[model samples]
Target: MATPVSGLCSLKNKVALVTGASSGIGADVARLFASYGCRLALTGRNMEALQQVTDKCVERGLDKDEILMIQADFEVESDVRKTAEQTIQKFNQIDVLINNAGVYLNDSVENVILENFDRVFVVNVRAPLLLTHLLAPYLIKTKGTVVNVSSIVGRVSMRGLLTYSMSKSAMDHMTRCIADGLCFD
Candidate 1:
């Protein structure tokens, strides 16, 4: 069943930025947002998959220009900054920022190398932090929302995912801090 008008009203005509939108949860959110008449800026490492998602959004009634696809690798700092700038450049305003780009490394502390741990943290935690910082001004101007996608592992211990769990825990904390800060701002 569809959500009632009151529930859906706020999303219509809003501009949303969704990372990791080439597939999975990010793509699904982008599609739903587009269906609600939201303009979207999508980013991911896979251009082909991102294009497919954009096509689906277009089919859902969004014009080609209403959707912007940026291919960005979260591990690269320059790419992360560029993604935010490009989104703002295209849309002029951002009403929603979904920090959903992440990496999962399945290895215990005993086997995980420093390189793997660093890569996971960079993608899962640092990138989101940087993106949020870069877009804070625009988001504040519009009183926009920021949705940080976290994992259950952050709350509960999981085997073979030490780095992943830690990164998610950091994200959860970051969300709380940002929310509190926003309340004051």
Candidate 2:
């Protein structure tokens, strides 16, 4: 017989890797996942905020050892790679990958520059792609899911957030392609 669902959001014992988890939606999700008994590898640019979130998870009944917090600058290739490596090293399995890390460049298309544009895309678009690539094998083994957090700006033209919007659009497309590519019988 099929098992009955528990609580409102139960992800018990599942290993989840959440990016941009220091403060914001990522942090909230991590807390929720923890409350539901998920093992987590959470990455963000701020160590302090990450620790605070970790503490909150503990307060929600998770053991301190159940969470791994990594300080990462998503725009840096080495940091992105390290985030994936460390997560796999800790959990040895990843059931959920939440791609919520993003960088916002407040520049219109007219004012956008190559340097700023590169930074935004590297953090908002490329890092998640690299993480998914590194984690795909584990995800496939578990038949897991990937959640890419994006903005409405991706679907609409935002005058001052041209680069950010474009980057999220790229992220949305990348998610779709990965989802399609990872489909298995």
Candidate 3:
């Protein structure tokens, strides 16, 4: 049986980079991809947590040389760029890029501070944009794909999440704009 997204049974020759891979959806996606034989570059702020995920991948039969774990805080543009550089250095090219690092707060506008707003935008919006920009040429070279995890909050506004919603809205628009601007043959 073949994988759902691609017809091939394995991604043996492909390389992928997954951000926020310490846990949750990112971790799951990385595991799934690894099972398909995709070499991975996984990133998260917590080194220990990222190592755990990598360990799981190793247990699943991925070779030690096939996984690269990068400790990064996506809020920092420098870190995001360095991640892209390191991944390229490790894999030579990235066949897929997953921007999955994100944060959420239950607090409403009244309780949300300016710092909170900045952190949300920096991680959820700016960081992804910068990373995408840095790695676009390589993606184009490989005819690769970028999957960004966006929230429904961007389209539906609810109380207490004003800033988060705004950031997601911006992220959605940015995604579309990048897709339109980049022409893939």
Candidate 4:
């Protein structure tokens, strides 16, 4: 027998924070959530792109104030912390945390510069860790869920993207550990 969907998944009156909301899968996810009536906090380094996505959310019947855009580089810890703090202040609670901010250095470690690898780690791994740490307490208060954007490379090895894959491997393991820890009685 198939199970019926619950109203809890409707996302109505819920608040979601999506990093890397400017483009790609993150943008699409934000749109889908908006269609389900979720108020969104969209973050990206590109102000124009973030506003464009927010505009679409408003057009889709989300209130003008329902969408908040934080334009900051996810590689910075201060920016990550501020994004979470501002979202909590605006929405009073966050129903979902989408750690969609990430980078793909499409090169092997042999050819990849040290600085480039560091930036990839900062954006892909460190940023999500810091953001989740900041939001864990708030999420606990609401029993909220977290959605992390990880790549298939984490499961299947590829020719390039060695560091990127490693970071995602760490993220996948972290997700499992967190899920285990957050499972309630």
Candidate 5:
């Protein structure tokens, strides 16, 4: 029998690891997921901002123990690995991984420096790929979902954002490749 959409979408007891949860879309996603009864492992570079989001989630009905806030800079490989390890250690399993951390460097093609371009790619594209690789085994074990947030600029390029746009475009391509590979498995 086909399950009802409500039953299918219910996040009760699911463990979600949301990156960039300190602000904006990531913060909002963490709040909504918590409201749906999912245990959360929130990560970002800003400890204060992440704590505020965690407080908001607690107010939304999740228990204090149901949330784990890890302050991590995605650009750092050790931080990325530690974040994943801590989440797995806390929850034992991860049912959802939201890769929403990204960097935006506003520079035209001529003005963009190699360092700035590398930073954008490292945070926006490489970090997500690394996280996905690290968490793929858990995700496959539980048939969990991985959501990689990309920008509209990836589809339609914008002026003065060459590096940012390029990074997001790589992210979009990586998403497509992962989706295709998943279908075969």
Candidate 6:
């Protein structure tokens, strides 16, 4: 019986923190991780959506207790911190950090403003950095991995996604730096 999302790595019983887990890629990742038997800590701004995702995980055989749902908005730095604290409080150890939360503004340099740019950066770049920082100790101890969900927009410029593109580019760099800094061998 082969599963849909095959894995070269073993994920059974591992703990994963997936941001933006209410929808899109985040929700899909949560479902896949649950299928692999990874304990899940999912964060998103919408509880109703989060619960729907949770239901899918439950359908995948994760006990309701095996999953922790956090209603968080990455625009708030404190929410980012609280996400880490809450996940750690529940799971004690985190084996995977999925920085998938993000905000996108359809604006070009011509119309871009600090408020919108900051919102994009805070969620796309800063949230991942802060979560990695807060969970560094546990990640180090467990030799865990960080998956920053970045888009091609980061590398290829688009007219209406000026701020989003820049933030994702920064995210690309952040992922590389984190991988290097966390190298144990």
How well does each candidate superpose onto the true structure, as a TM-score?
A: 0.95, 0.94, 0.92, 0.92, 0.94, 0.96
lDDT of 4: 0.86
Model 3 misplaced stretches (Cα beyond 4 Å): 1-10
Candidate 5: regions farther than 4 A off: 1-9, 183-185
TM-score of 5: 0.94
lDDT of 1 by residue, 1-185 (tens): 23545655578789999999999999999988887889999999999999999999999879999999999999999999999999989989998999999999898968988999999999999999999999999999998999999999999989999999999999999999999887424
Question: Which one is best on lDDT?
Answer: 1
What TM-score would you give candidate 2 relative to the actual structure? 0.94
Off by over 4 Å in 6: 1-9
Query: What does candidate 6's lDDT look like per residue over 1-185, in tens digits?
Result: 12755462388899999999999999999998998888999999999999999999999879999999999999999999999999999999999999999998899878889899988888899889999999999988888888999999999988899999999999999988878778743
Superposition error at 178 for model 6 (Å): 1.1
The residue pairs in collision within model 5 are none
Error of 2 at 180 (Å): 1.3
Q: After superposition, how far is residue 173 of candidate 6 from its true place, in Å?
A: 0.4
The CA lDDT at 130 in model 6 is 91
Model 5 lDDT on a 0 to 1 scale: 0.90
Predicted candidate 4 versus true structure: per-residue lDDT over 81-154, tens digit per residue: 89999999999999899999898888885797888888988998889888888888889888889988998998
- Name the 10 consecutive residues with the lowest summed lDDT in model 6: 1-10
Q: lDDT by residue for model 2 over 1-185, one digit each (tens)? A: 12334642557889999999998899988988887888999998899999999999998878989899999999899999999999989989998999999888799867879999999999998899999999888998988889999999988886898899999889889978887788633
Candidate 3 lDDT (Cα, 0 to 1): 0.88
Q: Candidate 2: RMSD over Cα atoms?
A: 3.4
